[model samples]
Target: MIWIDTLAQGILLGGLYALFAAGLSLVFGIMRLVNLAHGDFIVMAAYLILLLVTLMGLSPFVAAIIAAPVMFGIGWGLQKHLLNRTLGNDILPPLLVTFGLSIALQNALLEGFSADSQRLPTGAISTASIDLGVLTVGVLPLLTFGSAIAVIVGLNQLFYRTELGRAFRATSDDATTASLMGIRPGNIFAIATAIAMLVVTLAALYLGMRSNFDPNIGPARLIYAFQAVIIGGLGSLWGTLAGGIIIGLAQTVGAAVNPEWQILAGHVAFLIVLLVRPRGLFPRAVD
Candidate 1:
């Protein structure tokens, strides 16, 4: 029963990790642009939500509703004006650019918010849990996991069923040819990033609610996201979820044995997965 509970909690925890990686996976799938600042962007959205809540007394959910569109615009403009120029046959440019952006964002956040940790208020939901015969589960964790699944399902539908998704796939397959077909690769890239940032806003909502966050923590979050993405296979949303579960399960099981091993266990799992399948468990065909 103890182990069952631990596994259940880990799976729930994986939902948050999946949220963290989903946007990163989406942008990479469409544009092949690795936004090194992805985690910082998540933090930025959290701050946005906090600001809205603090100023307007809005609930976290409502604040997120306001923040998502704002973030989408930021993403659209950033991709159109800055990141688009960095895309090419050479991958180093995007990496260097996003790395610089990451540094800039961290310093900016530190200057604004300081090093103090912050969390979104959830009232009773923070402590609320459901009792199962064999195990109990927190309402917050269940909500987070549900959100992750919804996001994945929504994204899959968007990628496969929508006209914009068709544009995304075409651009991804061959940008020059996509351009020749009268599709604006630049516009598609911008929209893709905007969509990614919208997802970031969703991720931020869960992240800020789930745990205390500080300006300096973005890089560590990025590490988890990167691991999840790599573990699931780059550009695969469902794979990303599985990777998150793997890490989450490893950490929970490790902590069961020895609390000190929790973080190390997740890293070890990632390394083991890499060793076994260098391309990841469900790598995209192009990858």
Candidate 2:
């Protein structure tokens, strides 16, 4: 009974981690640019949510709806104007640029919102829970997990179905060749990033409502997201979800034994996965 409950809860928790990593994975898989500021962007979106809720008295869902498109534009413009310039044959330039962006974001958030931790006000929905036959689940967590699946499925559809997605894969395959084919690699990257930011906005809603977050917290989330993507193997949404579940299950089972083992367990699982499958549980053949 205990194990069953643990597995169920961990699976749900993985959904949240998947949400955190989806945007990161999307950008990385498509452009190979690791947005070091991803966590901070999540934090930024949270602040946007906070403002909307507090000032406009809107529900968190509505706030997310409003913020996602705006975040998308920010992401698109940022990539077009800034990150595209940093990209090259060598990955180091983009890494350095994103790292600097991370620092800048943290400082900017600090200046604007101070160091105080904040949470989105979600009313009673934040506190609500559902009782299953064997266990219980929080509504917010369930919703986060559901959203993660929806995002993954949606991304899969987009990747396999749309012309833009075809361009994205082609761009990911060979930017030079893609450009020669009249696929503007820079524009593709910008659009990919914009979509990623939309995912980030969704992640932010759950993140802020589920826990109190400050600007300093994004890096940690970024770490978890990185692990999940690596463990799942890059470029596979289902793999990412599996990776998150593995980490989540490890953490929860560890916590059942010792309070502090939660995070340590997840890391241990990540290390084990790396040891056994260096390329990840699921990876592209050539990529």
Candidate 3:
């Protein structure tokens, strides 16, 4: 029964991790540019939510809605002005630039918000739970899981069904050819980043509500997101969710056996997967 509960809880927790990875996956799928600052952007969004909640006295959900557009603009501008210049045949430039951006963001956040950990207040929902026949599950975790699924489904539809998505596929396949087709790769990239930042805002909402967070924690979250992305296979959204669940289950089961091995267990599982399947559990056919 205890093991069952742990497994359930772990799967729920993976939803949050999946949220963290979704934006990363989207950007990679579209642009093939890895934003090393991806997690810091999530932390930045959390702080933005905190700011709105503290000053405007709005709920976290309301704050997220307000922050989404602001984040979108920031992402668009960043891609248009900064990251766009870094894109090319060589991947190192973007990696180096985003890595520097990550450090700068961490320092900027630390200067502004300090190192103290903070969490968003959830009122009743923070502690709310429901009993399933086998076990009890937290309402917040269930909501997070549901939101992750919705985001994935929405993104899939957008990628597959929309004209913009067609543009994305075209740009991703060959930027020069996309340009010949009158699709501005720059604009497409900007839109992709903006959409990614919107997803980041959703990730921030759950992260801030779920646990205490400080600026320094972004890199750690980045590690988890990176592992999830790699374990699931790069550029595959559904696979990312599966990867998160695998890591979550590994951590929970490891902790059940020995609490100290929780984090290590996740890393071990990732390594095992990488060793067995270098391309990941589900590599995209196109990628």
Candidate 4:
């Protein structure tokens, strides 16, 4: 029973991890432009939500809803005016640029919020839990898991069912060719990033609600997100979720055995996955 409960908790925790990686996965899938500032952007969104909640006495959900469009605009402008220029055969430029962006965001956040950790006040929801026959689960965790699924499903639908998705696919395959067809790859990339920022906003909401977060925590979150992305397979959304679950399970099981092993356990699992399958459990054919 203890083990079952542990596993269930771990699975729920994976939902949060999945949310962390979804936006990173989307941006990479579309543009292959690795945003080093991705996790920092998530943190930034959290702060934005916190601001709205503090200033207007709005609920966290409402604050997140308002933050979404603001984040989208920021992403769009960042890509359009800045990140797009850094894209090319040489990935070094974007890497450098985003790295700087990450540093700048961290410094800015530190200056504004100080070094203290913060969490959104979720009230009763933070303590709410559901009883299953075999095990109990937190309502917040369940909601996080559900949101992860919904985000992935929504992204899949947008990618497979919409005209814009077609443009995205075409542009990703070949920017020059896409441009010839009257599809502006640059603009499409910006829009994809904007969409990704919306996902980031969702992720940020859950992140703030679930745990203590600070500006410096972004890099750690990025590592988890990146590991999940790699473990699942690049450009594969469903696989990202699976990867998060794997890490979550490993961490939970490890902690059950010995608390000291929790974080190490996740890294070990990621290593094991890489050893067994270098390209990940579900490598998408990128051609």
Instruction: Choose the strongest candidate by lDDT.
Output: 3
Candidate 1 structure lDDT: 0.93
- Per-model root-mean-square deviation over C-alphas: 1.0, 1.3, 1.0, 1.0
Off by over 4 Å in 2: none
What lDDT does the true structure give each of the candidates?
A: 0.93, 0.90, 0.94, 0.93
Q: Per-residue lDDT tens digits of candidate 3, residues 1-287?
A: 99889999899988988999999999999899889999999999999999999999999999999999999999999999999999998989999999999999999999999999999978999899999988999999999999999999999999999999999999998899999999999999999999999999999999999999999989988888888899999878999999888888888889999999998999999999999988889998465
Q: Model 4 misses residue 235 by how many Å?
A: 1.3
Give the per-residue lDDT digits (tens) of candidate 2, residues 4-50: 88888788889888988999999988988899899889999999988
Cα deviation of 122 in candidate 4 (Å)?
Answer: 0.5
Which candidate do you rate higher for TM-score, 1 or 2? 1
- What is the alpha-carbon lDDT for the whole of candidate 3? 0.94
Candidate 4 regions off by >4 Å? none
Q: Judging by lDDT, tell me the better candidate of 2 and 3.
A: 3
The residue pairs that clash in candidate 3, if any, are: none
TM-score for each candidate, following the candidate numbering:
0.98, 0.96, 0.98, 0.98
Which run of 10 residues does model 4 get worst, by summed lDDT? 278-287
lDDT score at residue 15, model 4, on the 0-100 scale: 85
Clashing pairs in 2: none
Question: Which is the better candidate, 2 or 4, if ranked by lDDT?
Answer: 4
